[model samples]
Target chain A: MKYITTVNGQEYIIEIDQKTEITVNGERHGVDFQQLAESGTLSLLIDNRSLEAIVEEREDAWEVLLHGELYAVHVQDERAYRLAQARGKLSDASEAVVIRSPMPGLILDVLVEEGAHIGQGQTVVILESMKMENELRAGRDGVVTRVHVGKGDSVEKNQELIAIGDAEEIKEQQ
Target chain B: MDNLLIQKFDKVLIANRGEIAVRIQRACHKLGLQTIAVYSDADRNALHVRYADEAYNIGPPPATESYLVIDRLIDVAKKSGAEAVHPGYGFLAERADFAQACYDAGLVFIGPSPKAIAAMGDKQLARQTVRAAGVSVVPGTDPGLSDDELIAAAEKIGFPLLVKAAAGGGGKGMRPVHEAGSLSNALAGARREATAAFGDGTVYLEKMISDARHIEIQVLGDSQGNVIHLGERECSLQRRHQKVIEEAPSFVVDDELRRQMGEVAIAAARAVDYVNAGTVEFLVDRDKNFYFLEMNTRVQVEHPVTELVTGVDIVQEQLRVARGRRLRYLQDQVKLKGWAIECRINAEDPYHDFVPSTGTITAIGLPTGPGIRVDTGLYEGHTVTPYYDSMISKLICYGETRGEAVLRMRRALEEYRIMGVKTNIPFHQHMMESHRFLSGQFDTRFVEERFSMSEREIHDELEAAIFATLVAHQRSQRASQIVAPGERDTSNWKWYTRWERLQR
Candidate 1:
């Protein structure tokens, strides 16, 4: 069986040919792992090198902690990957940048107006949650097409607040 | 003669939460006194609440409704019969009114006199007070300085200064002006941000001391007019004005410099008539010219570094001072024996601009061994709500030399683990391995401008990929498999156990 894994914008083509053998990015390796317990601890032996990490499954991704750093890994089988590619849904942020509220909060301010060009890491919206004003920044640079939440409006977790598309699309709308 | 006959308080009501509260409880226990913990609705299962002799629910999770409510805190103290209240670092720690209320309620505040807190709390008044004692302060103009006046002041204070908002903190409304040409534009931008964030446009100009290290003196005072300094703590490693790493007996500061800074710190404490534990912060330039920054009226977050080196328990001294007793040590008795370092373990993603991360801590593996002390109010199942500061714990390591301490800290960082939330442990680990940090050549802006944690490559990426894929494959396989019932209901292991019993 073959699987496609994406991590930090890098993709890996993994093939599980044998029980204790696998190939990642065209490199074959002998790999075996045991789940220590329910605490997400994993003792892995890859190519006879013993290692340990804490791995947990989230809603849409597999989070792996190695050497005190976390890597959010997205994996899909070969067919699913091809299907996703056909549908143009590959978790790419530069295509259509959407700003979602990470937690429940009130929209303190909308710093950008519609049809405005915003840069990556720019504070597009200010959300006040738990009495702390957190600046929700844009994940990628794009032209804003819609402002979903207005100032002073309450928002829930994962609620989309703004959508930014390519510059050409905004020009057409204008 | 009977000043020590009556104890100040039999029970201490800790008017704080999290690790500091637990820290205070440990101190009170060492003194043979009871501890009363007050918690918000969100902190019911917190380690501090569980460790206290008695716990009380004050109010809701928000600080305005719970931790900062003076009346509610006092009510809990009174109901619990706690004769003294210890305000830990944040929350109501530095509130002079809270201390006054504690005094008015006939309770020992376990800190400085209310007048002292008020004087130091005011930035201008603190400058004036410390200046009267011949202590040099950072050159700056008064608050509400207009843009035109600021431009003029910038020339006097020289270039590479900071235009800071009077009512701003956490690096908001703060702009760095490298030259006079940008001072006006910087002022306008800072004013706008300040007005929007703090609702006040007041601004000030301070001469930014380049190549400066943040060294603070720890002073402990008793009600008997005796005060002594417990040496100095180097806290130059900061991110956005918040301390990330701290160590005692700064590498830059020698014995003579330590004594000089200690005297200045003691002088500032005397100026305010400060009682209990306080830290006098200073900005020491490259030329060894140290100027007083401000005084932290309460115990600081990095007090453990000093405690580990000087062999002094500051919290216990605070309790003793609250009891109207003399200080335990004299100035001559205080000594810095070895090096100690502390890393603040915050629940923030260092890779992603240090944004606050919140979730339940499903599992925690604390580091233990030689020269390690972990101060935290966390447990396995504790939920890290987004209602407060992101710092979940402090990992401190002690050693006879700075190199040894750094090595121990690196080892401890590798051993420590906290699941279900992001942390800056990797950042600390990277710093421990960095050449600049090991050589003590970095300044306050090192983290903000120079260092990069994400630039380094993860060595175990291949192994991680392999394990994750294997786990995912196993899970998918298990979900697809359908188990069939066997002829024997019990397993082979159960039959073997029964056979052993029959043989017996």
Candidate 2:
């Protein structure tokens, strides 16, 4: 089985075979799914040492407790995984991009017009939350493609607020 | 004599809110003084407001409209006919103008003289004054150092120095420069922070002493210029320059060293003509040499440890000093005994980068024993307001020795509990169990460097089990209480209604 894991915005492709041992980022580990189900624990061999991790099935995910660290892992079969991969490819080719709210807050001000040019790290939006004002900056130099929110808008964590794209990227899409 | 002393002023109006308000209220009641509390609209049911003989709403929730409005506070005092006002520790406590306003209004301000506060509040001037009084200070640029002069001074004093705001405290407006390459950037950063925090962009540079311990001398001064020190407190256990655990009579100090430090603190106080209670802090190195840090002109958060061992009511003494009283106890009469420790319990999630936790305190089980005391402003159903400091309580424990004190503190923590709002109590418990802390061999970076979630696997496992059990119980209860056809759903409807209420 192959899985894609994204950690801190970085992606890694991991493949696991039955009873096969693997080393990840310099740490050696052996994984056996069959043994895991029988013992209700997964035996992990790390750095030539053996450790046990408790695994439990929760709603739509597997809750794995390794050395007391709990991680909610969403597992998918081959068919569903392939569909997700296809969707990722389509999104990668699209010029329309979503900007995520960096933190939970009320949108106090939106500083850019729909077609305004924005330099990298330029403040485009101001958010007020927890009694502190934080400015959201442009991640890359680009023209403002669209504005999804307005002033006095209450937004949750990761809600889209703006869209930006380079002139070259937009022309290529057209 | 008794009749004359008790002529008037039975109730002391606490012109502040939060932990310090509760602290003053406790002290006032202990001294047979009634407490009158004033609050804003948001604090109608606050713990401090409830603990007073009378409560009145001043204004809205914002501090500028309420706490910092001197006229409103004075009006409340006058209306209530309260003679004295205890400003607690923050808000208006250290404001010299507020103190003067209280004096002009014929209300006793339970703190130092307005002159003393003004002199100490300016960090650069206070540094020069203390140094002139023969107190050793860190090698740094004096007052009125230009940017170019500051850079030159940094080069002379060497790298790894500190850039500090002259008008700031509380670990704000500070930057550490490790080398010449980072000097310009650090200075700019420090200046920006200074402006943002204190409305002052002026900063000063100092040689950052490596492996130094933070030890402060608690001093008491009277109207007659008599000042005495209450030994030294070891506040070396810090995170980001904020103290976590503080102990009195440091492990390094002997009788001779204590006497020397005490005399230096007294000299520093008298040099500024300081009156009332103040803390003269210092940075002590391994060679027994100490450099004066700064003079805190107001009451400190860690005053409980000093009071525990010395049997002195610092707040009451501050009131007496403001009333033109002489020193009640002479220098030779002061005696320190036992070991005392204080842990600042902040409403922060230790697992989540210590982010402030704001919510209602659903449940609380405070630690109580012969030697344990919790100075807190929170109650079981009180909301941990996001508009104020994250700190909710200060837990102090006293014993005959440091070892006993640590053991007692561990037990006290085990017995303590607070739900619905996250706290740093778990971190305190973990530190109390760490070998380095138990042996007193830790430094300022101990908490940051030593403890991690992965390092404490067993404790994490226990926590997981407890959380799992709690969740499972809630699920089971919900399943069992499912309403059948024709059955009333009163209790379950309450939960649903409450959730709907929050959404609305």
Candidate 3:
């Protein structure tokens, strides 16, 4: 079976066959993996080299600890993967993904207004929760099409606070 | 003669949770005292509770309703037949009222006297008291000043000063104003933060030492008033004024400076008639001149470094002092042995602005071997809740020299393994390899303003990627494996149906 694996925004085409034979991104690799009796522990031998990985299933993603750093991995099957690729294309064509609140908090301040162009990693909103200020930044560069919340507004986890879209849509809105 | 008799307690109740509580419990057990752990609703399954000889539920998850409730804690201690109460660092540890309550309940408070805690608990009052003891403070105004007066005081004290909340520490209610133009605004912001966090908006201004380091001396006193200092710990490596890393025998302090700071620390403790284990913190500037910051009237969180370097078990001394016994070592007998460094392992994601992460620890691989100690409240399958502080463990390493200590810390950090939650281990690893940190050239702003994790890209990228891809591939295979729908020939109903069809 052929699988599309996406890690940190990079996609790889992996083909797995019987007898521990696999090809990753068109490059063949002979890998054997054994799930140890201990949960979330994996022992892998890649091209006769031994490696260990600790994996945990978080709420919506998988957290893998390799070496001393942690990586969040998101995996989707073939059909879901295709749908995600189409969605990505659609978003790139016109609109941008909406920025949502990562946790429940009070919107202490909003840095930008609608119709304003924003670059990626620019602070759009400042949230104060648990007595700490959290700066919510834009994940991608786009023009602010709409602002859904204002200062002092309490927001729930994953609640949409701002919508970023292509320049044309923002200009139309303006 | 009054202190000649050693008072003993059969049972001591640890009124705090997390690693500190577990630490106190260990001390109590070593001294042949039974430990009782009091927990909030959220900490029912905490490691401290499991480590205690007995456990009791005090109240709900919020500290105000549970751990910070003095009456509730005292009631639990009494009901559990505990003879003493040990409030470890946070929560009610530094609260004078809690200590008084413990005293009123006829229980030994395994800390300083209530008088000392009350005197030093107020930041403004502490400044006045320490200055009265002939120790120079950071030149801050007195409390109860109007906003207009605060601005005027800031101008007089100079443009660069800090507006600090008079009631609390830990970066809460503290704001640094670089010029007169921003003093009023900074004061307002500081007041709001202080009020929200500590329930007191009263703030004072102090000269801001831009290039200063946080150095604190540990002091132990008995009822007989014999106080001795335990050298100094460099806690300058902080993020937003919260200490992240600490080491004993500060690279900044030599023997003469250490002696001066130690004398000042002893004076501060003497001013308040402090007893048991307390920490006198100072802000040392670039010129080696130190100013008294505040006195922490309880055993500090980073006491382990001092313990390792001085070969003095601070908790054990705190217990003994509470028992009215004289200190084990005099001022001259107190000696500094080796270098010790401690990295506070907090359950915070360093890459994501140090936000608190919570989950059940699925797998853990703690570092072991010589000269390394991991004081932790973490257990396999233990859950880290969001209702408390993010600190999960403290990894301390000791060595004959600073370079050796750093190397050992690097080794231990590499061996430290925790899953199911994010940590600042990567950041520590980055710091271990940092040139400035290795050279002992960093200040409080080193972490926030100077240090950047982006620079230290994981060197083992190729290895990590290979392992990750292999794991991912195997996971996908297991998930996609098609299981046989059913045992086709083992169904009784299907067998009877086939027989009937054959008969027909």
Candidate 4:
């Protein structure tokens, strides 16, 4: 069986086969899906010892409890997994782009029209929260293609504020 | 002083928010006092609002228009028909003018006298009053001393000294100077911080001890002028001057030392003619000698640890005291029972520079069973807002001895679970397992020196956890897909089929 895993925006391809035992990330394990189902548990061989974990499905993700510690993991389907791998390859070629909240706030002011020209680290929006003020800064010199939200908005964790594309790169693509 | 008694009222208006508000509401309910809560726009759905019998939104999110606005809070108090107002710990708790407003409005204020609050609110004046009461204070000049005068006083007090704001506490507006060369800079910084934090930059000087333990004596006073101390609590485990863990009965304090500290605390309280519940804090050194620090004229966050050991409901006592009742138990009658430990459960990511983590707590399983008490303002689905203190809950454990209490606390921490937001639970778990902490051989700088994870360590741990998660995720996916269809063939290739099934 072959599977692709994405963690923290990074992707990895893993292959498991019987009699072809291998260790991944320092944890040695023999792959046997039938044994795992019969025992109702999966055991990973780490340092010549077996460690068991109970996997449970929880609302669009799998929660694996290993040694009394729980980990939340989001799994991607085959199509999305392929796209994520492609995205990973493209990211390696381009300069890393990062977006930061301009202000320490609730992001009450996002003034950049999407697909607008923005300089590197330019102040794109203002965040007003906790009785203080902060400004959102752009990641790199690029053209904003999509604005995720507008004025007087509330954003959750990792909610997209804006999308940026390199002007020269977009021109070349067109 | 007229007898300010709380006439029989069904409900109390808690004109505050956060953990303290929830604390007061719990105390009120224990006494059969229903609570009315008032909140700002930002805190309309806060835990305190949900905990109260009734909640009203006063104004906008800014504190100036809501919590700090005396007129608005009074209006809410009136509309709710609440007979008394409990200011909890902060916001309006220390505001003498606000307390007087409550008095003038014919509503009972569940705290000390406004005059007492005013006297103690000014740090320097409180020191002088405590000194006059024969309580040994830190060797420092009174407020209004010139720089030259302060420098000379510092020399007399010795090279290492502290320049503190006369109107501030909580590590604010305080500077520790080691030598004469740093005096001017320290004084200037202290003044600026004092002005910004307390609105008054009047600075004072004190002898700074290189290693000091913060011990506070809890004092309860009645309107009839009776006051008594409920022993001491050692709160030296601090980070950035905020207490992280607090325990009752100092490790070095014996019966004699406890008596002396209690007497000084009582004297300090009596000097101000204080009423209700208050804490007289002190800085103690290795030799058992202690000096008066400052008087906190409101209920403290660590009040539950005291309640657990002494079996006294300090908040209920404050209400009873406000109602012109005498101390229910005498000073000698109050018995300090077994050890009690309180861990402040803050909504902070200990791995990330102790930064405040704000979000909804999706799942919460509080520790139950004997000897474990959780005083939390948050419930499942309660959003921890950035508008308040990071402390979401206080988990206290009590037992026959310190070891028993610590063991129980460790068990409680294991049983307790909070998800959907980053918390300091892991940090507490690490600290509880530390050798120094278990042995109680720690000081204020213990956490800073020992538990602080280096940048490299943080990166490594994050990478490892992420890798492990990804691997587990892949294994689970393969197993699920293989098990989707029921096809069992266990005849010829039993081991092969088992291995193949597990691989899925």
Candidate 5:
């Protein structure tokens, strides 16, 4: 099956056959890959050149530590890619976005209220995580349609905390 | 000479956490002394707690409520029957009050005398004391001067002066003024910063010594008035006011200068009647003129570099001195053998402005071999919390030559592995490969103001693209090998087997 892999803003088309032959970005290469049974180390021999990498599967992507640097890779199959494309269009058409927690933390305070218009970079919430206070800001000019969290609420990684709608769209909804 | 009665302690309590605490615990165990550890809520599962002979929970995660609280520390020491207290560098190491409390509690404080601590804890007083001892100090304003008086002092010091907090260390409340017009503003800013950082707005003035090397001397003094210096450590590599790398026997100091600085450092310690382990730091100029900086009243974080070169265990020496024994070596016996380098591995992202990274360390593989030592408080599945300093380990390497030491450090850094948190390993790797670093021509400002890491990232894009493709390809293979629902339920082989069974 062919896959679309995006790494650090660069996209590549990868095709694999029987786990031995692979082509990346239209260049065919004989690959010998094996996952160590005891250790999570990945051993790969691409075109007879050896490479060892530590691969960790995070929530949204695979984080590969190769040669002392971390690279985040996002992979999607054909069906999933098409589904994601559809969802992207829907979100773009509505012109609304949900602001979520970047990491697990307690809400120190909420800086915006429902129906409050906020400009890009305006503080929306103060999150205390890892013993440091981080200010979550509005990514775009919009009106806060709903606040899903309050002061002192415990939040998880990527948990949606606020809904932001276009200034005109929220008025229409109300 | 009053503490010469040979006060021996059976157990020592370490009033700190993380790698330093672990390091002290190892030293205590080596000397056959029992060690007791005190931890906050955040360090319940810490490596130090597990390494100690006994452990107690002092309080919550915040240092103020736990590590910095003299009362809590004393109570824990008492409850644990610890005969002495070792406040390893940071939390209360330099606090004179804490040392006095330990003395008042009838417990041996494994550091300099409280009087010595008090004398050197205040930078203003320390300068005066060192100067009286005939040790040259960086020309700075005296304490208790008003704003106008300070401005006048700055004028004499000339443009390019530093407004420093009298009670400050660790670069917290320092501002550099480059001209006469900005003196007042710089003073106000420094005052505000000092008030916030050290709770003292008292400011001082110092002529800024550009391109000076931060070379500090490690002094060990006994209660018998016998003080000796353990050479010097070059700690000029720094960022965000924290020393990231250190080495012993600076390239700039020759035999003649080493002897002079060593004698001056001993005099500085003797001026305060210091006892136990302490460090007298100095700033050395390009022309080899050394000026006293300050005296750390306890074991320092970079003490290992001195130990590796001098072949002395400083923590064990602290224990011995607190037990009223004289320093094992006299001035004539003290020797610097070889070169040593230390790199502090902190859980900070070098690519992202060194922001603190905290999480469970899912995996770790420390370097091992001859001439490489790793002092760390980490284990697999251990958590790196954000309540304390981000330093996770100190990797030190020693060799007969500076080139050998640097090469060994590069090899060790390459072998080190850590997962689930960002670290500054790449920064160390880059420094190891730099020509300036190899030549030993850098200052404290070299990291923050001058050094760049962009040149090291040239091959990252190509490597990342290839690795990503490989990972995707492997993942697809794994997915294909898993049996589907229809394939698991019925198979052509199974049907054929059933027909053959019926015909038979």
Candidate 6:
């Protein structure tokens, strides 16, 4: 089985011929992988060196936290990668992006209202969490399709705070 | 104070959460005193609740509805039969009204008097009081100075002064003006920010102490008018005006400087009639000139560093002072024997702009060995919510010298691990290895201006890539494995029995 893994914008091709043998980026290495009893923990021996990591599978990537660093690793097998490339959709950069609450917190302010045009990197909402005020910014330039939350509302992690979409795309959806 | 008039409490109620609550509980338990814990809905299963002898639910998670509610805390104290209330730093710790409420409820507050708290809690009032006591203050205009008056004062104070809010801390409504040209605009902006943050637009002007270090003296005063200083803690390493690291026995302070600062700190505390455990903070310039900054009327967040070096359980002393006990140690008995450093471990993403991280901590690997101490509210399977401060733990290391302490901290930071949320561990790790930090140099502005987190990534990207790929591959293999029933519908044992019967 062949897997293409992208970590922090760097891509590597990994091939697994046997349970104990693998190659990464055209470099052969003997490997032993063991999933520990602890959920999301893995002990891997690559080329006779021991390394440990906590790996969680998310919707689009396997999240790995190693050495106090967090990374979302996107791993796609050969068939899936080729199919994605063939569709001419190698990235989802131009799609609508929803500004979600990163953590449970009290909404301090909603800087943008529905139908308000916003620019990339402009703060859209301010949420008070962990004893500090955090600004949620727009990922790209677009009109706010919907304002799902308001000031003083307590929100859960991943709940939609607002959505940004193309004016035409928003109209079509409505 | 007469020994016969001692006020002893059999039980103590901790009125805060997180590591400081647990720390005070330890002190109470050490003196054979029972500890009662109060929790909000979000902290029903928190570690501090489990560590106490009794736990009471106050209210919901939001501090306003629970932790900061004086009636809820007092009710819990009365119901639990706890005679004393220890308000750990934060929450209602610095609120003078909370202290008064405790006294009104016939409960001893394990901190300064309400009068003392109020006097020191007001930033402008504290400055005036300390200055009247002959303590050197950062040359600043008095509170209630008009914008025109402030501008007038700035000219005398010289260029490069600070416009600061008189009502709050943590760098709110603070702006630095390099020249007279921008003083008016700066004052307006600061006033607006101050109004929004503290509800008080009162601002003051002060000479900005460039290249300054933050050094604070720990003071223990008994009800019998006995006061002693416990040396100093250097807390210059900061980010956005928040202390990230602290150390005892500042690299720049010698015996003479410590004595001078100690005397001035005592003078400041006495000016407010301060009693019990408190800290007098100062800003020290490069020339060793010190100025009274403020007085913290409760146990500080970085108290462990002082504990590790001085071998003094400050919380216990606070309990004793509340009980009317005389000072246990004289001023001459205090000593800063060795080097101790502490790093505040917060649940924040260091790779980003230190955004708070929260989730259930699925696993924790604590570092243990010589010279390493971890005071934390975190445990395996514990959830971290955003209803409170981001600080989850304090990691303190001690040794005979600063070098060894730094080495120990680096080793311990490397050994520490937590799962299920991002942490500022990478930031602490980077700081421990930086040459500027190891040399006992750098000031308050070092973290923001001189320090960068890009180097020393210890990039385990290769391993992360392999593990992620292997995990995906394993899941796929498991999905492809067919677990169909045996060839025959009948059970294997029944088929074997029929074959045996035919043979017979």
lDDT tens digits by residue: candidate 6, B1-504: 367656578899999998999998889888989999999999998889999999999999877788888898998998889999999887788778989999999999999999999898777789889989999888778778999999988999998888887765655567778989999988986786566554568898888789999999999998888888999999999875678999998999999999999999999888877899899999999999998988989999988888888988898899888998887889888877889999999888776667788888877878899999999999888888887778899999999999899889988887787877788888998998898998878987899889887675667787888889898887666534432334555533345446547657
Q: Would you list the clashing residue pairs of candidate 6? A: none
Q: Of the pair 1 and 2, which is ahead by lDDT?
A: 1
lDDT of 6 at A10: 88
* Deviating ranges (above 4 Å) for candidate 4: A1-174, B1-10, B140-169, B172-205, B454-504
* Whole-model Cα lDDT of every candidate shown, in order: 0.84, 0.72, 0.82, 0.73, 0.82, 0.85
C-alpha RMSD of each candidate structure in angstroms = 5.9, 9.7, 5.7, 9.4, 7.0, 6.8
Worst 10-residue lDDT window for candidate 4 chain B reads: B455-464
Q: Each model's interface RMSD (Å)? A: 3.2, 10.5, 3.1, 7.6, 3.8, 2.5
- Listed in order, each prediction's TM-score against the native is 0.89, 0.72, 0.90, 0.73, 0.82, 0.87
lDDT of 1 by residue, A1-174 (tens): 799888877788899867888888888888777888667888888888888888877877888887677888887889889988977754553367778887676787899998899899899987765444577888778888889999889888789999989887667767
CAPRI docking class of candidate 3:
acceptable
Candidate number with the higher DockQ (2 or 5): 5
The best-first sequence of candidates by lDDT reads: 6, 1, 3, 5, 4, 2
Model 6 misplaced regions, further than 4 Å: A87-93, A96-99, A106-125, A137-155, A159-174, B1-7, B141-207, B482-504
User: How good is the docking of model 4, by CAPRI class?
Assistant: incorrect
Q: DockQ of every model listed?
A: 0.33, 0.06, 0.39, 0.09, 0.26, 0.49
Tens digits of per-residue lDDT, candidate 5, B232-286, equal 9999998855799999989999999999998999999999998998888889998
lDDT of 3 at A105: 65
Tell me how many clashing residue pairs each candidate has.
Answer: 0, 0, 0, 23, 0, 0
**On TM-score, who's better, 2 or 3?**
3
Better of 3 and 6 by TM-score: 3
Q: After superposing candidate 1 on the true structure, give the runs of residues whose Cα lies further than 4 Å from its correct spot.
A: A17-19, A23-32, A89-94, A128-133, A172-174, B2-6, B143-205, B483-504
Per-residue lDDT tens digits of candidate 3, residues B92-198?
77778888998899999999888888899877778888889899888778877999988777778996777878776667678778888888877887787666565
**TM-score of candidate 3 relative to the true fold:** 0.90
Cα lDDT for residue A79, candidate 1: 80
Tell me chain A's TM-score in each of the predictions: 0.86, 0.59, 0.79, 0.45, 0.77, 0.82
Per-residue alpha-carbon lDDT of candidate 1 for residues B146-239, written as tens digits (9 for 90 to 100): 7888788778888788887665554556778898888887787678666654456788888889888989999998877898999999999998
**Model 5 residue B447 lDDT?**
92
